[model samples]
Target chain A: MAMIDSTRRSFVTRIGGGAGAMALLTVVPHPASAETIDLPERESAILEAAFGSSVLTPGKISLDMPILAETGLSVPVTFKVDSPMTEADHVTRIMGFAPGNPEPVLADYQIGPRAGLAEVSTRIRLARTGFVYAAAKLSDGTLWGTKFSIIVTLGACVEDIFDLDWQRDAERRAMRAEARAAAAAE
Target chain B: MATIRISIPETAAKDEIVEIRTLISHPMDNGYNVDARGQRIPRHILHTFIVTYNGVEVFHANLHPAQSTNPYMVFHTVAVETGTLEFTWLDDDGSVFSDTRTITVQ
Candidate 1:
């Protein structure tokens, strides 16, 4: 009985290896691990959560960003979706996600057929050096996306006050003062 | 109530893609910060931004609390004809701020 059990185990191992190799050849589910777009595992997971069961294709998105950001406080980004804004077809919404930030979702925009064009430009804060993913949902339930990596020289969103420099600390204080002044003015 | 400022070129050639910039004066209170007494601050932020040209929507954004105090946004739109470009910002307190600029096509 022991000898027969050993033989069955070996047979099953051989068959499993063959099927695994075949499955790898046909499967490309996770582009996050691809060679060109080496998206971090956490970011990939965030993307999956942001758009569940929806396959994100790298198209229809024109992402304008820099390769290096001097500071993580404010980085300008522009995203445009190439779509025919007709009554029949148009972009319904666009969303920006930052995996490294405390809040994975940075921004969400809703558009409609009334929108003659689909585009947005704004500055976003990055917690660290990472990639930004922008996805656009079409009227037909299709989601298109694009991503870009940015290297941050000075990181933002550091909670520990002791970790910040004099200049940065001063800046934070000034920003707070400005916010208060604005509130008072209103 | 809030005040808004918009910047758009006064003139552009036909089919020209013109840039639009908007700035609003409001503290985007994220509600994450605590006061001196350690009481949590309630979040009050601009919820949406919309731009319309010639009575048609062109761009829109649903802002989040992470945005800065005074929100600034810049976008682009094709100058197909001469018309009014309107910018509207909606706040959490059921207030809306709007500004407009006219564009001429050469």
Candidate 2:
């Protein structure tokens, strides 16, 4: 009975030590890698530049877009923030980002107290199927945001053709100019 | 020359919220496409848009290449007194396009 009790005690100690090591492993690398792994570096940098150290709480902003877009050339996006629109408390700025686009920044809007509503609708181009994010900054220095995933069938900004010779471009331009001049003379 | 269009109600009540829609014609070339001859097309896009109401800036937008061609935007503002709303678009090539509309507030 004494030997059995000692074995049980030793096993419990080993299990506790193993659990502690596992917890340490998870805790040590989590915060450093989580942010980098969650978002692309460019997007994270842009958001950091815009919002500073403020945390982007995921609420109070409603971003609406089609779940599946027929094409990435023009996707209609609309966003509204729950704000009083008063001078003291209003949405000061709103920014949109498309992760898959060559240039991630879609648009940045600056709103003033005179804006009766904190809402905007615009068309944006997407390079491929990816996540679209919208973030809003309030007068109180807090930031709120939301993201929507969109599937694009036809992509944009990825055209492949071979007519990039500078000499050819200049010649084409001159020909067009001469044509225009001729038309003007006529 | 770009075609600029502004749509706003001619009149509104005091403190009434009115929607303002604006559209501009431009090829917001994102500088990513190569021509048929394999030449990259230079980027040319309208980078900024601003709306000034009653001599005060109310709404402004910073656009990028991700904005579609013929950028169209709709936003809301309060109608306070009678004033002119000036819409301006600033292009990457340093061209500025502007249009103005007057709104009467009762």
Candidate 3:
């Protein structure tokens, strides 16, 4: 897969830790470099109830998928479904769901007129081989869904990038407090 | 009243891509926290937040108390225009608190 390396490499975001939810990934992501992609039938049924079943066809949506991968913990994914984005055609929300994972709905993002680009990239984990689905909710109250897969090569999992426990945290906080005190009198 | 602080870095590009972060102060209660009576606190949450640009709603949410205490939300939206970012946070009781500040877009 010539496009595989360039694709997976772009998914990393420098958006550092901010919430407790970040640590919940321990049970969710699989090994590093090896990934298996799949999707459940119930997921499509849910969207069919919302968007009337025509949403999964890759009609106007511009999406990139990886044919092969080595990691399941932090895989890069981006999705952009075409829309006029006018009040009549704007996308009200874009939701991602990996049903096999601990959290079914990964994240729901709201988009508005000021949102310049239709493109979105983020790091996600695949527990095993499963389908990852993307859904777009339009302003008109309609739903759409698309499915994609990433083939795994290495099939080995890796440790999480962070544990976020109080032990490691206490050490970091102590150093920061020391620095703040020094700066206060300067 | 509990309130969340929102901050956007100065180095962030105007029209590139940026993650908007918001953290609201709330006991969240989760209906899981019990009172002296051993009764669930009845799930008090600041549900339904609206992010606006120039008086237009850009993003909104219907949040549940199950969301962690002092809920922190971050999402991506590309900036196409320069204007004040207005956030209206609503509570379970229909109470509304709003804040607005102009983004110094270069």
**RMSD, one per candidate, in order:** 16.5, 16.3, 13.9
Highest TM-score scorer? 2
- Report clashes for each candidate as comma-separated counts: 0, 9, 12
Candidate 1 residue A59 C-alpha distance from true site, Å:
3.7
Complex DockQ per candidate: 0.17, 0.36, 0.12
Better of 1 and 3 by DockQ: 1
Model 1 chain B is weakest, by summed lDDT over 10 consecutive residues, at B31-40
- Per-candidate TM equals 0.63, 0.77, 0.49
- Misplaced by over 4 Å in model 1 are A1-53, A67-71, A82-92, A111-119, A138-141, A151-156, A160-186, B1-3, B34-40
**Preferred candidate (TM-score higher): 1 or 2:** 2
Q: In model 1, how large is the Cα lDDT of residue A14?
A: 60
**What is the TM-score of candidate 1?**
0.63
Off by over 4 Å in 3: A1-91, A96-109, A117-134, A138-186, B10-14, B32-37
State the lDDT of candidate 2 residue by residue for A1-186, as single tens digits: 111233453465467653442111101112322232244678878978987843567777766666677778898777778899998999999988888876799889999779998988898888788888788899999887777777888887655222335477567757867887899999
TM-score of chain B of 1: 0.95
lDDT of 3 by residue, A9-110 (tens): 333211322222221111122233433223466655655554565244333333344544456544555556567665557776666666544335444567
- Please report, in order, the local distance difference test score of every candidate based on alpha carbons: 0.68, 0.79, 0.53
The Cα error of candidate 1 at residue B29, in Å, is 2.6
